[model samples]
Target: MGKFDDLPETRRRGLERMEQVYGFDMTDGTGDFFRYTADHLFADIWERPGLSDRDRRLLLIGLLSGSGGADVLGIQVPAALAAGELDAEELREIVIFLSHYAGWPNGARINSIVENAVAQASRPPK
Candidate 1:
């Protein structure tokens, strides 16, 4: 089972249906959004023409975590962990940065959500 397997049937069907509708020759976790973000978004968009992926990842972590995207950040956190790119302190720092700029309430909310997301991994691993 892959990461998508952990999701419910409804979401699985939804993503799959979207794939079928778009006529993309890909599986549930291999659609354009996922592929583009993982490959192009990271390798190309983040990699830039010269900037490092580390910098890009930090920027992305900040961008996602800072702008009230705890939900999205929650998802990416796992991806970052899977890729061995994120550390606890760094993740905490992203939340801290959000608190400064994105407002404390939003950042705190994200922190709670992030805590839950991190706990999710320890819960059976899907």
Candidate 2:
């Protein structure tokens, strides 16, 4: 079996989850990035036996905060809320908790970014 066919169910669920979380579209003929993301990152890594989606979200939040990934956070933060992986309060707590480990500046910056995203997600479309 091929890589995708190796775990068909896992691949399918991973693809669906990936789309739900990141709006990842492979249809535009983008490049290897999307293909790899779908086939590997989501299909393989995300389908691993352990670590719930919520766990992944929290990790991504911290990782992104330290790595200067505001653009990615714009997608992840709101999706976490919408998917019930996290609520606004939990995200706020994460920022506060991460502040010590990730340092004051980075945590504060992430807090601001996440808060704005939460607000936007809560607002009705204009």
Candidate 3:
């Protein structure tokens, strides 16, 4: 059996949800940080009601932009696109809109990441 085969229901649900959100398998992650991420962050926080996944994605994009979370955005942008949570046009517009508030440098970085993600998505898999 795999390492997480006997995980509790919450952790199991979190791992499932993580794959749904990120568009990739999450079971390969290990250690305490990954444990808490699946157990709490994904299970409790992301599963909370009142906000759709798309809503959360948009909110997270803004927060990431403001905080200069380019690295995280590198992950999030592609996931958002793959999940159909945000399209390239909407993403480009977000960068334009956020440029005024999040600062030009940060916005520019996000714009580049968004474009790259879009480009990568359009390419046929090797």
The CA lDDT of each predicted structure is 0.59, 0.76, 0.91
Instruction: Tell me, by lDDT, which candidate is best.
Output: 3
For candidate 1, write residues 1-126 as lDDT tens digits: 744467655445454433332233334455677655444443344434675545655676678765777666665665565455666566677778778887888888767855665666457853
lDDT of 3 by residue, 1-126 (tens): 654568888888788888888888777467999888998999899999999999999999999999999998998999999999999999999999999999999999999999999999999999
Q: How many residue pairs clash in all the candidates, one count each?
A: 0, 0, 0
RMSD of 1: 9.3
Give per-model TM-scores. Answer: 0.55, 0.77, 0.91
Where is the poorest 10-residue window by lDDT in model 1?
17-26
At residue 97, give the lDDT of candidate 2.
90
Q: What does the lDDT come to for candidate 3?
A: 0.91
Arrange candidates by TM-score, highest first: which order? 3, 2, 1
Residues 1-126 of candidate 2 have per-residue lDDT tens digits of: 433344456455556657766644432223688667766787788878789888888889889887878778778887788787888898899889988888888887879877997898789999
Error of 1 at 18 (Å): 16
For candidate 1, report its TM-score: 0.55
Question: Residue 34 of candidate 2: its Cα lDDT?
Answer: 66
